[model samples]
Target: MSRNTFRQASLALSIATGLAALSLGAQAQVQEHSQAQRASAFSKAQGHIESFRGRSLSDADHSFEARDLVVDEDGAEHARFDRRYKGLKVLGGDLIVHSGRQGALQSLRQTLNRQLQIDTSPKLRAAEANRIALQQHGGELLSKQPELMIYARGDLPALAWDVRSFQTKADGTPSEMHIIVDAQNGRVLEAWDDIHTAAANGTGKTLYSGNVLLTTNSVSGGYELRDPSRGNTYTINMANRTSGGSILKDSDNSWGNNATSDSTSAATDAQFGTAVTWDYYKNVHGRMGIANDGKGAYNRVHYSRNYNNAYWSDSCFCMTYGDGDGTSLRPLVSLDVAGHEMTHGVTSRTANLTYSGESGGLNEATSDIFGTMVEFYAANANDSGDYLIGEKIMIGRSFMRSMIKPSADGASADCWYAGVGNLDVHYSSGVANHLFFILAEGTNSPLGASPTCVAGNTRVATGNASLSGIGRTAAAKIWYRALTTKMTSATNYAGARAATLAAAAELTATLGSDYSAQVAAAWSAVGVN
Candidate 1:
């Protein structure tokens, strides 16, 4: 199942009003303390449903299962519970209890509109719902019937069929689409991709990474470049077609000549990139695999004629890349590109940040952040670590986004604003990307090369105070912790700030107050306050 985040209450009224009325240092202290209290409550997570329902949700039915608990830095607690009625799961039925330092009930956040009441029996058959779902995704139907679910779409509850279906693309990249069909009316209420494909490199004298050893399979007649050592991560050639391209075969195990003229060279790069990325996540973060399942995802290179984009599909459980038009771009299989796409799989398995609004921006930024880290981890001479993304993709500029100065991309934002959530997720991601750069390297890095802030065209300092670097290691740890533990599916920038601050508090004991200070500064720099 994809990981999801729950919503939390915003900053208290008094705290929000005090920032403008209070002195600068005092305001920082107050905001820090308030954020700490919230984080503390979020971390403790020991709030009981009885206590929560008693004080805040008095009218709520007590049929609930405690799902998660969190305590903030000030020892406050926030408890999350899912409602179940008559042994059936209540869809969209969730409640959160906020408690003070002494475990006193403070507030509650509830998604249940009212006591649910609806007919459980369906007028439509499961087979009909299944057919409707298959039609919704435009994919071939499978034999299995849809599963019955108690669905609530922000209104009256009803029985629904959670239909699962799959779509195999012309290039053999597969994806699963899930549709929620009304059990009584068979209306398609909601549909989402079970496997997300959104847009990787390597080598044995490969196109990107040079002179690397490869693991292969000795097939019936020839050798295939399929690795058995690292979760069977292999590569195939799409043969410039949309579907059903045969796998590239080699007489000898040796592959590639560091050029795209030979398809094997591109495949070599894909294989090497996958290996390095897998090793980086495993060795550095100690994550067993993308999903922590020890299984490997494959790569499909040369997808379609002059296809400029690449995407990672969860349904196919692999990364698909396109060869550029040979003029504006080359193959999409660059090292950082591989890291970026694979991180999408990791995101899907973890927080599963919703692909809309601020959460969507966070999702994109997480991929960029981890992708950059992966590049840094590799430290390959062919593709050196840098803040620039897809530098090897384009011919002239050699960059997709610059984390240090996101505004340099022209479309990306440098700071948060009132309508930022409305911007494209790729552009909205600039805020977090800027914050990451400032946090890891600082405003004026020790190397004397740091990004300058801008309010449109005017230059400005990043935050209220001069910031210091916490280094990438500490910053990555805090981010990983927050993404995995503190964040949910619907978490936004405000929630992200809370989560990161909570992570900072947890890190203080081990990494020192300096690290925490820099984290706060970085967020403040990006106008997160």
Candidate 2:
């Protein structure tokens, strides 16, 4: 059973209703008063909706609905809202409203600034749009009907159809592709996969993290690999199938002997990884679960024969792991790998960064940053914390990616460039990975030496050639804050720099030091400015 219980309650605020005949200052004060009296952050934002919208509140054609809510340590609240025009979802028309501790408006960031003037009437039929999308996708339709949405990401808005389809990739990985087709011409606007895989390439024969502890639920007959404490997050044996699996059970409470020969060994590692990741987010970030709701996600192990990947699917709201070919990889259940996959779910719930281009690179980098944080938080002696990702899963290679100097992997980029977005998301992610490492550990740390793009002659120097880290805890807090509150779907490398700097500014009081300068320097060091 999957515990994806996160839900967004619609606000009853009327778009056409005008505020009382009072000065803007007085009206804002009244809104602030109402916000302080509210219970949850969403409700608080609901009370201040008019103030949040500013001049846009007068636009009766549009309405805003809360998508996510984040409350910071200093009683600051950030609420993300998705815009709808004439009851139709407006793609890329999402915004976040930041409010200070006393409910005063701080700032607002939005993906789209253009006014909506598109005709709702579609010239092409939904079936025709689906056909066009299917022609491009070549996959089974996940939904029978396509939803009509206002596409606002481009220079002008247009009515479009959002189509979802599923297909197995050539590498045996599953793809849940979302395609946006124009209703006016049936032309494909954008397409991306929702099933975020751990690594594009490929995991091994044993439990890499030795003697890890797991929390399982007790049945009348025996104990099952289910965590009652963490949203009933459980692990199941997929039996080498693409879909459906059985929850692992044990006559005795003990699991796996650390050998891949026994199926439970991989399950044990998967369960342990999940538990540690869940704890890391909760203990460090104060997030309750993957979706910040008290619900648990499930895990599927031993998926497909000789399968070489692991991924997190929002549709299934569970993590799926593959048993490797045994020659190259064994089982893809390393702790950092688990953290990386689960953070994708967190990204989906928060920023929902577009899974392509620079935004996609940030999405991947967010996972890598948190994955490293989870490793350090776990502090497992068996699997020591390091900047290397998927180190335990690789056979011949040392690791999948290295954060200290991303270019060490040969394929990943060490720093950002003008056309860096053209690279694959995994390779483009190197820029941000290097930034996070330098921000947290500095240039010449124990992890490894990191070179600036200026030193590499890739770009001219814009800021400090060297940086002093503000430390990992502070860096993680800033990144997490930026990801949840400041970032939108289309935020690019420069936008990421701005978001992190803003995050650092907000965290100054708690962090007891202003790291905004260091954050900017680190981004500049990676040529993001």
Candidate 3:
């Protein structure tokens, strides 16, 4: 609900047609306009329409069929002709005139466009708009709790545009209606609605709650889980930590190093990124905050100017974003960035791997794995995406990080080897990214897996640890369990192997019975064993 403002604005004048040009005839009209009985009836009707623009009319009041009506000095308009839909808000009343829809609608669009100063008609009606807003809004919800914003979306489906909005429903998830609305005009131009149609024969719900978001804390921006007893394993806390300062401050007592950077845009990026990501995670994932136990984490965005990267500092338990060159080449602080950065939080919560050598590689891999998953789930427009990373924040459409082809980044490797962890954290991430990519998707033999890693084991540690390929989906599931259930402080590749096996074992217990062979096979495919 929004407050109504009473302001005097002139209504665009239009000449009345036929009887609209005549004087009042009915006694009701004459009695109301006793002093102006000789005036044109159209003039009386216009006055009635103008009277109720900004003010609310009684549900029983049926006055005139106000059309092309403009608000008067009181900023109110009254609609009494259509009592059938009078109680309906926003779309209520008989203001709709189909005959003049073309001109009036076009003019209304023009009016709103001029008022909001926006073009391309992205006004909640465009397909991409829904995507971006979701990235910014829903994505934030999810960062806090993966289960909160439980993604009912798949690799996002293309949105179809309607008259005032883009509308459509995704393929798999029966929980949501993909929609963008022109808030100004109360029109839906783009929509992926989940409302089941008797004819289309569909049934589903869009979200747990469409209007409200639950926060864990009373903190100005923090959000809590809606249901504390859900399958959450941690109490997740979300802080709009958009800078090193904020990140350092957020997790003062947490068990992680603070990733520090001096980038200027880092703070801003982090702030927005954190808000949206946390919300996305919280709403979609249905978990508490990042830790899932309701512990609040801080975020810091703009640390320094001209800085070109973003990172999650485990030591500090905070996330930071950077401004990369003038083009905003910063790494991880976008909707996907937030999702990726915080997935590190999720990984840390679950995996707790060391940030160096094999463990460090595992940590990086964990971030990329969930990060990509979050992106697919979000289905946002500003970042409606692929498995690519840093698409918008970095080099235009190019991905700064790629699990399928780590070499594409010229920094990360596509597959893990015995000594791959010896590299820097950024580079060490290549192996896990590769592992995740394969785990989520599949082998490169299909030609779509970006074959830049043609060098094979050349990027691996100097060992004969050659790896085959495990399908991406199986790999991701195994890793998710490993990080969330069995990982410990002394985590290493061997530890990861053991923990993941245990996680796999535990998963199999609930799922069926046997996953030992598959888990072992997956690890070998990533060259882990």
Candidate 4:
């Protein structure tokens, strides 16, 4: 089937599910409560625009709209808002306002550190901006409409046109490229792709995890590989194609023998991986699903013939895995990999960290951190929990990455440098990966020995030669809180330090330990201070 046809079918299925869900009284009440909460949060944020803006600007010049509302465990409300100046969207003017349960304002965090005082009118025409962006893109234009918005991510804010283009890689991976063009000067300010992949080098099968229990939905004829308990999250077979696959169905609920020849084996791995990742977030972090909306995201297995990578797409709200070449790598459906890819969706909903530079590194590290945690959470004897990522899928290598010492990958950085952000995000992610390892397991852990920047003679800073860990549970909680509450789209290494420190301080009472010092020391050990 054609890609467009499959997408249409998926949409129809979703619509039908929505209609069926709405017919139920319980689902109706849940929908109503969600809407009511959104409305209330929006109204509360709208009333505090002036206070959040923190400026003397006229209210008419600026307006606020809530994009998402997250209620913390402590009854604190964090409302993320998109800003508009003079009826034009401000790209980097998004902010999150934290409020007490009593509706009292606590604090505000924004992407734009400075006030918006730039001219609204663009000197260049939209058509010219589009042409410039297309010239730089050199690909098919997916979105022809060049939206005019105030770009404030840099040192100075400027009117810009956001253009998106599309292209496919040799391995059948899709790329949705975004180009931010300065409307005043017709310069391509920035460009990035929407598709976030698992590995830079495409590489991945079997009933690798052995016999495992799966949650399947019973249909009229047979049982489908769908988990009704978890928002009906299901797995589909891609038939070695880039797009359009059928849902896996079985005569009985039992799935997969310990072999790779059976197609259902890969499906079993994918389904099991998704289930464990979902449970990890729900039980450990209080996250219902990827978007924390009590909804599940589907998974696509056998994405393409000999394809060696997996990725998460926000546009489809789904995860796609690839069957490996059966040489260096096997299937890319390992438990840690599943957790890593799904965490990308969580990061998108929370920090929405830009996928470039230092923020990009942090984004990758966040996935690696949580991915490892998810693996440990499972405690599967077939696939034992370890800090090494992709160990189960790798055929020759010991693992894809090591959180204990990221430098074991031969490319990842163990310590942060001044120009570390210039490196590829996957490699630069080592700094945070190492920091998390040190924070969770200390410098001399039984798993592996982690060295500090000072021990490595990378920097002469105030760092502990031997640092004690605060345990994985406490460490993961601190990082999760920082990611969901304090971090922003433009957050860098320094911002991450501040966010984690704040999160550690906030949880000190509950943890019964002052993790703030350990968090700070971890950052300093990684040369982030």
Predicted structure with the largest TM-score when compared to the true one: 4
What is the C-alpha local distance difference test score of each model?
0.68, 0.80, 0.41, 0.78
Cα lDDT of model 4 by residue, 10-29, tens digit: 11111101212221244346
Query: Scored by Cα lDDT, where does model 2 land?
Result: 0.80
The better candidate by TM-score, 1 or 3, is 1
**Superposing all C-alpha atoms, what RMSD in Å does each candidate have to the true structure?**
13.2, 9.7, 27.3, 5.8
Candidate 4 — which residues are off by over 4 angstroms? 1-35, 55-58, 201-206, 455-464
Pitting candidate 1 against candidate 2, the one with the higher lDDT is 2
| Residue lDDT tens for model 1, 479-510 | 87677656655677887988898778766765
Query: Taking the tens digit of each residue's C-alpha lDDT, what string does model 2 give over 61-173?
Result: 78888877787767788888888988899877878877788887777787786678779999989889889999988898988799999987766878999998989988799
Minimal lDDT window, size 10, model 4: 8-17
Best by lDDT: 2
TM, every model: 0.69, 0.89, 0.45, 0.89
What is the model-wide C-alpha lDDT for candidate 3? 0.41
Worst 10 residues of 3 by lDDT: 197-206
In order of TM-score, best first, we have 4, 2, 1, 3
Which prediction has more favorable TM-score, 1 or 2? Answer: 2
